[model samples]
Target: MPIHGNKMKKVFCYSLIFGILQLIPIRALGWGFKAHRQLNYAAVFTLPPELFKFYKPHINYITEKAVNADKRRYAFADEACRHFLDADHYEKKVPIDTIPNAWNNAVLKYSEDTLLAYGIVPWHLQRVQYQLTKAFAEKNLYLILKLSADLGHYAADLHVPLHSTENYNGQLTEQEGIHSLWESRLYELFEPNYDFFTGRASYLPNVSETIWERFAQSFAALDSVLIFEKLAGLKHPNKYSLQSNGRTNVKVYNEAFCIYYNHLLNGMIERRARASINLIGSLWYTAWVDAGQPDLSNLKEEPLKTENNDETLIQTLFQNSRIIGRKED
Candidate 1:
């Protein structure tokens, strides 16, 4: 497998973990979940499907005080890691004077670390999913917005390559801020023109494959992201910038960054966005299927399952954390 192929695997693992984390209760889980980006319910605007069948007309009817409309207010406790790969110990493994691409030949040197990062992601997602479902069952209802947020979080994670690795930011390669540079910065800058032609319906039979495939494609770009980012840093009109709020004086982006970066991504940005939109929709569809096809028309049942399930996930994690804490003590 290519070096980035390994990293892509890590990103897939994170999605599964995020799904698990959604299982926790809102109170226990806290507001950290918002760190994950919200999914667009606008997808439903394009097609009226199962859940929105009867409720279709009122789909946009602002439900009064049911679910929080502003998702950005809530942040997933574990989500901060999504913006950048955790490489605190790299200073020990790497020399202080090192730049990102310095280790062109060192990709495999940290293979184990890369694999470990990928492994942690899924558990977190699943934990959250458990909580969200239970929470919805409690009120005997599911909030489309909240559910979309959770679903989107996992779906988005699937699309991020660095989420799949220890070198998420390309720190090993000196691409220190590549994670946010690509996921956050690049998207924020180019999202307006991003392609919406993801097409109709999905083809994946298994959820795992869906996750890995998306992640692998993302990971495949790691090299280009890392190497090209460096090139961008060196090429832009004194501003081929990155994760840093673009307004900064970082000359990391220019015609060069655009050229090489796009080449590296192989024109996957718009496609990836489309995939993200569709994946969230598909996941929502699948979740309903797993719930035995809940009647989303009846507001009384949907959000209840979402919230109540979320509460349960929170409780489980607390219990686990307590156990681990006591052991450590």
Candidate 2:
């Protein structure tokens, strides 16, 4: 049967709409997989020759596996709290110092349930830093790589403003989907123009204090993140458009609107991304130094004995504890 005129025109129109919809991205959590990989990839270059030599070869593993923590969120109930901390939920506008730096102290003061309910990123990161340091001390190639990749994910998460807020996805402000719009969409669009050269990594005098400081910086930027999105919405009336995801139509920020929002943000996304890169590098270097600067050039490349399954990794990392908290996407 030969279709012509109106029938052909209708088929072409429907095809075009579907094609365009495929081009738009669905919402993602925590900087998206692309940005996370890029951050881990860039951080490797910031290492000194001593550390770089060892990391250079396994850089791909680190980069590709940087999203493991994010993946663990879906498999393990306990993994979600490790990626973010809703500080405002604890005490709005309080100094970061008010929260205990040590996990034991935090558990004592806030109770384990309370800490888990809000989030435990800063605390969990410190624990992982110690684990990395121990891995370095023992010269365990497998644990070193595994812990390093996980560290990069959590450290990068701390740099996101939404990760530090109660209104992480902007459901509170009626700016839903702003999480992915800022961290994932903008980076996917403008990352080519970003400057990733953050110089060499440095040793932190105090790891715990430094982690708290980074969280504070991210929290301080939360207001700007929310406020500017609203401003961008007001400036661009057609802020959102419906796109099909093969399942159903969902609202997403318009491309032009994303550009306008990025412009209003004044390079904030890039700065934070660079910050994440630098922080990841610094933490890796710091852990190695704290572990007595092991000679990695001669360490044996032993494959990790674990099954490489999500559940296996989660059990190994978290011990399958029951996590009680609000899992913020």
Candidate 3:
């Protein structure tokens, strides 16, 4: 069968659009990469003199590699689950007290499969904190830096309201793309004025309890995150505008709509970002303290080699199965 001119043009256009969409990175899930780097960079100053002196020398690495966890989602099949926890998946109304704070207990009650099926951010955070503490104890400079960067990424993720819910991207509420609009787009526009000066980091006696508390706070805010966005959409029916990404035109929330949305939220993004900064710094400091306050100032800075074999294997498995934990995209 021979195709007509209009049909041929339609086919070509659709192919071009799909190609452009493929160029868009799949790692745009959690806090935007830009925001993650900024958060990690600002968190360094919150450390005490002992830790700050050591971290200051390689602050660039800490900031730049903060998005490694997000990048790993493509290569590691289980990595996606560490970025979020769909609290509502557990029960109606999301009773924080009913959910076990400890991983072992939660796994016992809900089964590991069930827990991972939704997400395991809060529990995984404690695991990373332990790894960081062990790295500090061993004074393994490479692991310390790598684990610190990973820790910061997860800590920031925990503060996002969408990360605590099943409808993370608002796909369930007919407001798809709200995840990026709330965390990424708004920060791109208004981050310049956000106050990142979260005082000095503090020690955490119990990491598990502290993380669960943070989870609860984020879950509590999920309602407003959804409702206000709905209200904003009702107010501005023409909320999106076409913008070029150097390759093709894409729909994005307009600046005016973003400004209006931010107004409705009343600095909620700024507050959460500040809290993330504080939590990252505090977790780093706490890990150091728990490791008996290691003298990091004298550790040798050894260049770490990049290892991608495991990542390659995991990526192969992911492609074969085409299954992943909850994700924004």
Candidate 4:
């Protein structure tokens, strides 16, 4: 929880000018906080008994903290960019296949600022996998649990169709706010009836390829996400509309319209949610296996990490700052 000199400076500045950046009322709507928590909670059941035993004791922590990455967006200037990747943003000049899987290579080609400007979710997911592997090998309970929760969140983000597109919220296409409508509103409304029993975790032979493939699939689905919403709007018109609040002000959406839209999408939201649940477990198990299958039995009896006041300060600033919507999704 310790912030380095520069990050500390950023945090200090955030405290001074809290809620100064309110250009848009929208927040970066990931898979929604509840789905994230549920996905992480379900992922624990997928772990092998040996690993599951350690995680089972801390399942609540994992589930609750799954949105820490999203929360961090309020505290860190660079944090927002890590939650999404506008893959089609680069497709105009850069072929999707040509983007490097490695961080250093991507930086060399596109420059660090440019990549961060777009997103580094896939590359960052790759980086966290290594960190989780190292943490597991060393039996660092706190680090392992922390990385596991974060990895689950990032993997879920990658599966979101909006997170993979330049027109994430349909802002460019006059479908503004569609990002939250698809990712947050629909799922939150209807997810109770959806299934969560996605089977056991398995080891991934190549994490990079799998991560890239997920974003590729998400990118391909972007059109359907937009097209269906527009068609549903035409068919349903004002029937499903309702009003709500944004981070700073009022907002609106149609529940019945969303339900009908969800129906037209043919279970896409459920499929993505299910895939996230399955992939999260697989990634966690894969990291553990690659780390030589460390014994977690002893660590379960021990406390993971001690309290840190720096984290408390950062959290205070996060609450004070009303910043939202740095990246589209």
Q: Could you tell me every candidate's TM-score relative to the true structure?
A: 0.55, 0.84, 0.87, 0.85
Q: Write the per-residue lDDT of candidate 3 for residues 1-329, one digit (tens) a residue.
A: 98789778656744553343344434236788889999999999999898899899889989978977876665567898898888898754545977898899999999999888888999999999999999999999989999999999999999998988888888888988898888889998999999999999999998888888888888998898899998988899899999998868998999888988899999999999999999999999999999999887788867564334334544454354332444345
Candidate 2 lDDT over 120-204, as tens digits, reads 8898898999999999999999899989999999999888988887799888888887888888778898999999999999999
Which should have the higher lDDT, number 2 or number 3? 3
Worst 10 residues of 4 by lDDT: 17-26
Report the candidate with higher TM-score, 3 versus 4. Answer: 3
lDDT of 2: 0.82
**lDDT over C-alpha atoms for residue 310 of model 3:** 31
Root-mean-square deviation (CA) per prediction: 14.3, 8.8, 8.3, 6.4
Ranking by TM-score: 3, 4, 2, 1
* Candidate that scores best on TM-score: 3
Show model 4 residue runs off by greater than 4 Å. Answer: 1-27, 92-95, 243-251, 300-320, 324-329
Write the candidate numbers in order of decreasing lDDT. Answer: 3, 2, 4, 1
Question: Residue 195 in candidate 2 has what lDDT?
Answer: 93
Name the better of 2 and 3 by TM-score: 3
| lDDT, candidates in the order shown | 0.45, 0.82, 0.84, 0.80
User: Quick one: best lDDT, which candidate?
Assistant: 3
Q: How many residue pairs collide in each prediction?
A: 97, 0, 0, 1
